[model samples]
Target: MNPYFARSRNDRLAVGTFLFGTLLAVWYLMCVVLPHYQLSSDYVIYAHYATMTILYFQSLANFVMVTVARPDGNCKALQRNQQTESAHCDACGIVKPPRSHHCKVCDVCVLKRDHHCWFAGCCVGLRNHRHFVVMLTYLWLAAVYGNVLQWTFVGDQLGGHGPATWFRIVAPHVALLTGHVTAYQFFVAVMTFVGLLCLVMFSWLLQMQVVQIYHGQTQHERETAVTKYDLGWRQNVTCALGSRWYLVWISPWIPSPIPDDGYEYRTSAKTD
Candidate 1:
C-alpha cells in the first residue's frame, strides 16, 4: 500500500515487458521475416540484416550501460558536503550538488538527475545520460527500419494494403477468435502494432532528450526555462555526452568521457 514502493514494483513489470517484447520482436524479424526473403532468393536481405544487426547490438549495449552505470551523487565531493544546506537530501543525508536530485526508487541522489527510466530500472543521470539518449536513437532507427521491411509483408498477409485489412490488424484478437486469421497471423498483427508503437515512443523520447540536451536542460529545467546552463548547443551536447558527441551513435565502447565529475557545472554567464 505504500506509494513510495509502487514505482519500484512497476519498474520490475516494466523490465519484464521490455525484455519480453524485445525478444519476441527480434525472433519475429530474425527468424520468421528474414527467412521469408531468403527463401525467395532475395539475397538483398543480407545487407538490410547487417544494418539491423548493427543497430540492435549498438542499442542493446547502450541499454546495458544506461542500466548499469552509476551516476549517483556519492563521490567525495557530495559526500564531504553533508551539512544541511538548502540543497540537502535528508534521505541521502548529503548536500546535493548542482542539478542533483534524490531518487526514492534508487535510494540515492543522482547527479544531474534527468529522471528515472522505469523500463531500464535505473536513474538516467550524468553518467548514463549519453547512453540513454543513444539507446533511444538506435532503437528508434531500428524500429523505423524494421517497420519499412515488414510493412509490405504484413499487408500481404492481412490480404492486401487496405483500410479493411488494417481494421483486421487492429482487431487481431477478434480476427483470431472468429477464424478469419491464423495463429501466426494473429501474432504478426500484434507484433506489427508493437513495432509501430515502439517506433513512435522512441521517436518522442529521442526528440525530448535531444531537445533538452540541446538547451542544456534536464526535463525539470526545460519546463522552468532555465537558460543559465544554456551554453551553445554544441557545448551543451559535449557537456552531457562527451567531446566526441558526433561519434557516440556509432558505438558506446568508444572512450569519450565527460570532462568533469558531476560535482561542478558551468553556467551561461561564465562559460570560461
Candidate 2:
C-alpha cells in the first residue's frame, strides 16, 4: 500500500478516537457536570468553559500553523550560506543542512530534525518547532484540564453499586451487553478513562519536548546526548521559539521570528 494510504488508514484510529472522545466529553459535561457545577456557582461554569474554549481554539490554531509551516530543510538557502558541512540525502536528493536529516515517513529532509510525530503526522523540524512545542503545551493543558474536570465532576456519577464501576471500567461493552450498566453509564466510564489515558500520554510527550527545548537539542540529539548546540536554557528557548519568546510564550498566534537561519546554530562552549 502507498505510504499515504497506510498513514491515512492508521490515523483514522486517532481521528475517530478524538472525535468520539470530544463528543462524549461535551455530552457528559453539558448533561452531567454542568448542572453540578451550576448549582455551586455560575461564574465557575462561565470561567471554566471560557478557558476551555480558548484552549481549544488556540490548540486548533497551533495545529493549523504547525501543519502549514512544514519544517522542511532549506537546502537552497543552506547552499548559499555554506555555514557547515552538508550531507546529500539520496532519498530527498538534496544536500541537507548540518543537524538536518531526512524523514522516510515525511519523504523530506527536515532542519534540526526532532522526529516524525505519529500524532501530528509530520516531521517536526526548524520552522515549525516553535509551533509544535506551543501546540504540545496547549494540548497537554487541555488534556490535564479535561481529566481533572471529568474525574472530579463526574466521579460520583459512574456506578453507584458494588463493583459496577470497576466492571464498566474493565469492560464497558461487556457490562452493557450483560445489562449491568446503562448506555449512558458506559459512555461516562469509557470517556473518563480515555481522558486519563490522554493526560498520561500528553504529559510524557510534553515533558520530553520541554527538556529537549531547554537543552537546545532535538530528539535525536537528546538520545545520543549531543551537546554541540546545548546553549543556555534561555538561548536554547529563543533559538527554538524566537527572540520575542518572552512575549509569545503563552500562545502561538503572536509572532516571534527565530533569530538565525536554521542552516547554522549558535554552538555551546561545552561542545567547542
Candidate 3:
C-alpha cells in the first residue's frame, strides 16, 4: 500500500486542522457572536450542557472498540472442496487463515474479524484500532470542551443580567426583529440547536456503547453472532487495548502478532 493512502502524518495534520476549525467555529459563534447581540440565556445554557455531554460519548466509543473485533488480512474467497485435506481459494488462489473473513471493502480476507469504519475512511482493524479510538474520543472531548468554553465565556461576557431584562433592552436595537425574538437572540437559539444536536448524537452513541458492553458484543459482532464466536467482554478488551494497556499505549516499538504464511489454508484443512 502507498504510505500516502494509509493516512500519513500530513493527512493526520489536515484532519486535525479541519476538526479544530469546525468545532472552534461553532464555539466562536456561540461565545462571541451570539452573545454580542444579547441572545437568549437558554441558548447559552444548552451549549454548556452539550459541552459536558461528550465524556459519555468518548467512553461509549471505547466500549465499541472492545465490542468490534477487526478482520484479519489473510482471508480469501474459496470454492469449497469438502473432501480435500487442503483446499484452494479460487478468488485469490491462496489459503484463508483461521478466524479470517473476507472484507468486501478491503477486497481481501482479514484475520480476527473487525469491522470497517467509513467515517475514519479506514479499517478499524487491529493495527489501527487504538489510534482510531484515541483520535475519535479526543475529538469528541475537544468538541465538548469548546462548547463549554463558548457558553461559559458568553455568560461571563454578558454578566449576570436576566434574559428578560436583556431581551427588552436589546429589542429596539437588534436587527431581524421578530415579534418574539431579536436577530441576536435567534442566532443564539440556532447555536443552542446545533449544540443540542451534538448532545443527542453523543448521547445515543453512549447508550449504544453501554448496551453493547453489557451484551458483550460490538455492533458488528452482535449482528454476526451466528457465524462468529463472541470472545466475551474480557478478551475483547484485552485484545483491542492489549493485555498490558499501559505498556501497549506507552511503548512505541511493541509488536503485534502477525499471521504465519499459509496458516490460513493449513488451519482450514484441519477444520475440514
Candidate-wise lDDT, in order? 0.80, 0.72, 0.46
- lDDT at position 217, candidate 3: 48
lDDT of 1 by residue, 133-214 (tens): 8888888888988898888788777888788677767788888888888888888888887788788899899899988988
Q: lDDT tens digits, residues 1-272, model 3?
A: 31212144544564455445455555565456545555568867676546544443443354334324333432333323232334344555555544444555545554444455444433555555554444445545655665555564444433334685345335423423544545655555455445545656655654554444344344565565532323455544554455554443333235443222223311111111
Task: For each candidate, give its TM-score against the true structure.
Answer: 0.89, 0.85, 0.48
Give me the overall lDDT of model 1: 0.80
lDDT of 3 at 128: 50
Q: Is candidate 1 or candidate 2 better by lDDT?
A: 1
What is candidate 2's lDDT per residue for 13-51, written digit by digit as tens?
654555465556656666676676555777777888787
Q: Count the backbone clashes (under 3 Å) in each candidate.
A: 0, 0, 12
Superposition error at 82 for model 1 (Å): 6.8
* Model 2 TM-score on a 0 to 1 scale: 0.85
Q: Candidate 3, after superposition: displacement of residue 197 in Å? A: 2.8
Candidate 1, which segments miss by more than 4 Å at Cα? 1-7, 38-43, 82-86, 270-272
